[model samples]
Target: MHREISELIEIGRLLHSRGWLPASGGNLSVRLEDERVLITASGSHKGHLTREDFVVVNLKGEVLEGSKKPSAETELHLLVYRVFPEVKSVLHVHSINSTLISRMAQEDIRLEGYELLKAFEGIKTHETSISVPVLENSQDMEELSKRIEKKLREEKVYGFLLRSHGLYTWGKSIREAYIRLEAFEFLFECELRLMPLA
Candidate 1:
């Protein structure tokens, strides 16, 4: 348990250093062996996270440990863990590119013909394409979860955007998840730069 928390703390610091998490902009969580999630507490700055800055919550989003409240986006992380049993970590990153591209695209960001596409699972070549869904933002967590659930039911989601908000992704481990996060950020920046020429 301590090791898992330490890993999350390290990841939080790395993310903050990359400028993907500004202020209290993103959330990080790891699925424990017993299925409870160790997630960053609400409003805790990612750059300055401590062991106490994380809280444990069940799959239902109920707090089981720690003193602070979990992030408001807790349901989203729980949904990933529930829907995909293999996922061990879920990361929500609020980077400038994710925020901007989520707004620039109408509904989804279609990524194709990029070497970075290989960063996601099951992709070997740049010839293939995948569309990252972009949903309109809503403060109503339940409603937002429902909408996201609908997407999950229909699509092969590597990650998603909350229309001008941020990116949500999950992986079998924290390391894998962070790799995809970096890839997504790179693709988003490329797309933004090429938009004018399109």
Candidate 2:
């Protein structure tokens, strides 16, 4: 538990410093055991997260431990765990590129022929392509979860974007999750740069 707690705090600080998680704009979580998860509390600055800022929740998003409130998006994290049993960590960040690019696209962001595509798991070269699904933003968590789950069945997704919201990515561990987040951000920026301005 100490290992997970410490790593969660470090990831928060790192993401905060990178301008990915600003002011309380993002949430993170790690699955612990089969029934519990460690997740960021609601409304806390990621850059200053302490151990106390994390709360334990069940697979159903019910609070199990800690004084702070679990992030409202805890269900989103739980959804990933329920869908992808291999996922260990989930990171969601609101960045300029994700926000901007999601708004410009209608259904999905098609990224192809990028050298960094290999940064994702299982890809060994830039010959592949990936289309990240973009869902319309909704305040209803259950509705959003259903949409995401449906999409997950259709593609080999590394992450997803919420229209005008942010990016959500996960991995087998905290470090790998962070690396995936970095990869997505880099690709998002590159895609933005390639677009011609009106």
Question: Which residue ranges in model 2 land beyond 4 Å of their true spot?
Answer: none
TM-score of each: 0.97, 0.97
- Tens digit of lDDT per residue, candidate 2, span 1-198? 899988988888888888888888999889899679999999988999888899999998888899988887888889988999999999999988898999988679888999999889999888889989999989899999999999988889999999999999999998889899999999999989988895
- Residue 137's C-alpha lDDT in candidate 1? 93
lDDT of 1 at 31: 96
What does candidate 1's lDDT look like per residue over 1-198, in tens digits? 899888988999999999899999999999997889999999999999898999999999999999999999999999989889999999999999999999889768889999889999999999999989899999999999999988887878799999979999989999999998999999999999998844
How displaced is residue 48 in candidate 2, in Å?
0.3
Q: How far out, in Å, is residue 156 in model 1?
A: 1.0
The CA lDDT of each predicted structure is 0.92, 0.90
Which 10-residue window of candidate 2 scores lowest in summed lDDT?
A: 103-112
Query: Whole-model lDDT, candidate 2?
Result: 0.90
